[model samples]
Target chain A: MHEWTIADNLVRLVGEAARKEGLTEVSEVYVKVGVLRQVIPETLKTAFSHLIGEIEFAGAELKIEKIPLAVKCRDCGSKKAGDDLAFTCGRCGGIDLEILAGDELYLDYLEGKGNGE
Target chain B: MKIAIKEDILKEEDRIGAENRREFLARGVAAFNLIGSPGSGKTSLIEAAYRELGGELAIGVIEGDLASDKDTVRLRNLGLPALQINTGRGCHLSPLMIKKALPEIDLAALDILIIENVGNLVCPVSFDLGETAKIGLISVAEGDDKPTKYPLLFREAEVVVLNKIDLVPHSDFDREAFYSGLRAINPAIGVIEISCRTGEGVEEWGSWLRERVSSPAGR
Candidate 1:
C-alpha cells in the first residue's frame, strides 16, 4: 500500500535528475531496494505504471534491483549474508554484528532522451 | 543521454527529520516515535504513560491515522496538547507531516513529544519522524511471530514494548519466542512488558521515558 508513496518519491527524484540533465522524456528509471526496505518490486512497478501517464514520466520504464541483507561482524570483521536473520557471524558464530546493507531505498540514475532529440 | 545521478529518494525525508531533531533539542524536548500494528495497544500505552508521567513531564502527542481523529480527540480529552495528521490514503506519516505538526505544539513548554505513527509494522519503520528513539509495540494478542515476520521494525527499534502481557496467561503468547526473535535482530534492544489494562508495567515504562526525557545525554 505504501508502494505508491515510494513510487511517488522515486518519480520526483528521477524527474528532478531528468530535468537537470535537460532530458525531456525518460526512457527508464532504475531503483535499488534493499531487502530490509520490504518494498515489493511488482507493487512498485504497478505504482509507477499508475503515474507514468503524467507528462514528465510518460512512456518511462521502471526497473528495480533487489539487494540482499548483509551484515558486518564486529568480532571477525567479516561480511555475512543476513538471510538467516540470526545476526550471528557465519565465520566464527559470533553474535556481534552491525548491519552493512539491506536498508537502502534509492534512485541509481535515469536514462532518457534530452530536449530537441 | 544517461545522467549518473545516484541519490536517495528518501533523503528529503531524512533531512526534514534531522531538522525536526534539532528543533527538539533546541527546545529541550524529548520525542519518541511509537510504531506497531493497529490495536497493538499503542494508544492505550500512551494513555497509561500520560497518566503516569503527565504530572512530572509536559507530554504532547502527534497522532497519525489513515482517517478519523479519534486518537487525537482521546489524547486532547486527557488535557494534553495533541495534533492529528490524517494521511487519507497514505500508509505512514513522513517527517514533513511532523514538521507541520510542530507549530501546533508548544515545543518550549513540552518535555516530551510522542508521535503515534499510523498503525503499521512496515511503512512507519521506513520513515523517520525525528524522534529521539523508535519504540516498537507488540501485543500478545497479535501472536508471537510478529517480530520474526516484521524484522525491520524490530531490527531498528531501540525499545520494544510487549503490550498486553496480562493476556499472556489467557493466550498462547510464547515469551521465549518473542524475546529470542527480538534478540536475533537487536541484541542490545530494551524490551518492556506491560499491560495497560492492569497497569502491570507502566511504572517501568514511565521510568524509562522519564530517564530518556530528562537526561542531559539524550539517546
Candidate 2:
C-alpha cells in the first residue's frame, strides 16, 4: 500500500550509504520485505526506479527478499510457517502464539563500486 | 562491494511518530487512533462520545479521508476542534501528517485527541501515528467474518468496538460467532458494543475511555 514511501526511504538510505563510502554508483540495493507488508514488488521496483536518479544512483536495481510469515506456538513452543494467514499453531491448535517474523521491511545492503576511474 | 545498510523502511515515519508521542506526553494529552471500515460509524461514535462526555473532556479530532472535508465539517458543526486531511489517493495517514496537524490544534486546551484514520482495515494497522491507544470499529452490517478475514487489524488493536448494535435484531449478525472470532485473534482485547444511533452502551464506552484518558497506563 505504501510502496512509494518505502521506495523513497530506500533511495534516501542508499544515497546516504553511497555518500558515506564515496561510491559513485549503486548497482543494486537489497531489501528484505516480510509478507505482512503487503507491498507489491512490481510497484516497489517501479517507485525505486523512478526515484533512484534523484539520489544520484541512476542505474541501481532493487532486489527484494520475500520473507514468509513465521509464528511460534506459546503452548507447545513449536515454530512453523503461518499459512493462509491463520496464525494458529499447526501442531498444538493453540491460538496463543508469538509472531517471529513477517512484519519486517528494511534495507539490507547496497552493492556498488567506488570511484576508481 | 557490499555495503551493509540495515535500516527499517519506516524509520523516518517512526522518528516522526516518536516526536509526536513526546509532544503528546509533554502536553499530557491522551491521543487515540480511531480506525474502521468505510461507513462503519467512526464519525458517529465520535459525535456520540462528544455528546455524552463533552462537559468532562475537551475533544479534538484529526479526520483523514481519501478526498473530502465532509467529516471535518460534521465535527466542527458541533463546535469541536477538527482538522481534515485529504490524502487524495493515499490509503493511510502517516506520522508526518499528524506532526503537521499538531500546529493547528491547541494541545494545551485539549484533553483528548481523536485521530480518525482513513477508512480501511488493512493498510492503517501497519502505520503507527503515535496514538495513546489504537481503537478499531466494526459495524454489525460489516459481518462477523471481519475478524477472521482481517486478523492483523483485530489482533493489533487494543480495543475493538462493535458498533451499530441497535441494528443487530434487524441484521443477520451472529454475536457469538463475532466474539469467538475476535477472541481467537486477541484474547484480551476490549470489545465495547455501542449503537451511535440509539445511544445504547455509549455511557459504558465513555466510562472506559475516560478511564484510559485519566490513567497512567494509557499514556
Per DockQ, the best of the predicted structures is 1
Residue by residue across B124-179, what tens digits does model 2's lDDT show?
88777889988999999999899988877887788888999988899999999998
lDDT of 2 at B132: 91
**All candidates: TM-score:** 0.95, 0.91
lDDT of candidate 1 over B121-194, digit per residue (tens): 99898887888989999999999989889888987888899999999889998999888877777777898999
lDDT of 1 by residue, A1-117 (tens): 668878887777877778778888888888888898888899999988887767566888988988888898889998877456666677887788877878788898788898688
Q: Which model scores highest in lDDT?
A: 2
Q: What lDDT is obtained when candidate 2 is compared to the true structure?
A: 0.87
For each prediction in turn, the share of the native Cα contacts (below 8 Å between chains A and B) that it retains comes to 0.77, 0.61
Deviation from native of the Cα of residue A23 in model 2, angstroms:
2.4
lDDT of model 1, residue B93: 92
